[model samples]
Target: MSAEPPVSLRELRARAEEVVTPEAWEYLETGAGAEVSLGEAESAWQRWRFRPYVLRDVAQISTSCRLLGHDLATPVLVAPTAYHEPYHPTAELGTAEGVRDAGSLLCLSTRSSRTVERVAEYAGPWWLQVYVMTDRDITEAMVDRAVAAGASALVLTGDTPYVSRRARGTALPLQDEVALVNVQQHLAGRTWSSLEQDPRVTYADIEWLASRSGLPVLVKGVLRADEARACVAAGAAGVVVSNHGARQLDRVVPTALALPEVARAVADQVPVLVDGGIRSGHDVATALALGADAVLVGRPTMHALATGGAPGVTAMLRALTAQLAEAMGLLGISSLGGFDRSLVEDVTHARG
Candidate 1:
């Protein structure tokens, strides 16, 4: 524990409401559609229970794990979310520093308020998440920028071809007020944006994107075994099990519900990571135990940012790591690898 008393992720959340505009907080917290999907993801997390072991020396526990071929001090990776400047002036730069300080990787979004290079300048083991534009030229340019920015991996988020309407979350009237600054170059100083594409992007585009990228590419938003296999065959170096934070598509299965099949499909060919509804360090353990190589966390981190900016983010991440270590100790586990599918017994039917 730090010399300072530990604060719950909840305390940070309340701080976020006070610090950020009501509208921005709402936007950061809400999910799209009827929100049944978001509810499912959270509920899915509850069905998992860690079967603890007895009489083992696990006093000094570690949650360090490797992701995209790099070691993360914890299984946590900061999920890429755009427009972080809405809460703080430093934007992704501050988030990157917090991620580094927490010994984790930061995955940045293409829609980031900070340029990918600007972000990479302060980054620690970061990856870039891309949204393949419908226009091939724009897509190519985005890939080039990520490479130029020193991103170690290219993650094409295949989900969300359109904007999600997160009803419960608050947002600034200026939420639409924030322009896509980096992509603004594509507009060529023109008043019109013919280059912009619809949100209905697809896997075929992901395959095309992989062919175009110079760096190792990973496909985000894989929810099925077949999609996972297809991504590998299409030359993706890795895949993320996600549901766009349940911000897209209603009534879909939680990421965890589908993790095993995708993990088996990807097998050892490449690493498989998962995101959506991760709340605690134990959730990270549960993800690894369910076959996810690492976990991506977004909203809760945003909640921290809304609450305390850089300092709160650092605290939130550190607390989760400590919780993860505690969970590992209770399970008589030491190393991150000690978590495997054997650690989780699916209690869904029992939950019913």
Candidate 2:
């Protein structure tokens, strides 16, 4: 018989660290400043306890859900991360294929090593992540190109107006040929620093982008209830409670802790998704119970891509989904519709 593959994310990350260069590994692992936000994002999930129901008909657990009109086989999506080429030769295409195989969604970053069109060719349900450029024309053109290339929605990343300082120091510079394929022609001869996004971008831009592309807009990086509501009012189809995986801001409120307020502010008017330090199925369940309609995973997906290309990503996603289903079964919840605030208790307060 064939040997079993690694089903644990932690195991995959360890194996990936062994294969990738020190620079790449550091870039993937390090967060901004003291890394307190990064650590908190994962640990905060543990502060909540599941209050499982008994004697309910959870014989067949279904992990299906819908996000912005798209049906997802699972509530998880591969969150947009930059420069996949550092992880594997196939880069975003390999990641796309893995997400497709897992029957999940993918959010492709504008900084991807491959063009949006190329990645779209391999993906299933996909969204295009955009960092509004200092150059308005360039930003508009990118949005158009992604929509033309079959992106299902536009995920406007709002938290990274300026790059953060990483506590673990910088990675080695990317090679000249390691271009942002989607916008390389427009950026020829310019340093990556020249691509710095507009720090002053506002809600007006979100409205303009929605009008320009006519695609559903999801404003990522919102932590406050007011900000979440503002995004929706400004034409956001969804709001993602994120702190750029706690990479853009240090000591920010963890996304897990921030999700409840944002979710309540949006109040079902628009889907609320989150991404931070989610690493397991229990994390996924915790997000849902706190009011996240779906969750996006970044580091874990990158770790999987680094280890085994498309197959590793598929295995990682499958493992997460399986764990989620098992958790639902144990909680006596048969479907996502059954998830409610009552299912979770904030043990952090109770402990005090």
lDDT of all predictions, in order shown? 0.77, 0.86
TM-score of each: 0.90, 0.95
What is the per-residue lDDT of model 2 for residues 1-352, given as tens digits with 9 covering 90 to 100?
A: 1123327777878999999888888988898899988888788888899999999998777888977788888898899998889888999999999999988999999888888889989999899998998777778888999999998899998988898889995664577467556787777566665577989889988888889999999998999999998998888999998888778779899888899999889958999999987888898998998999899999999999988899888888888888888888888899998888988889976644
Return the TM-score for candidate 2, rounded to 2 decimals.
Answer: 0.95
lDDT of 1: 0.77
Kindly state the number of residue pairs that clash in model 2.
Answer: 0
The 10 consecutive residues of candidate 1 with the worst lDDT sum are: 170-179
**lDDT per residue (tens digit) for residues 85-105 in model 1:** 888877788888888888888
The regions of model 2 sitting more than 4 angstroms off are: 1-6, 188-194
Q: Number of backbone collisions per candidate, in order?
A: 12, 0
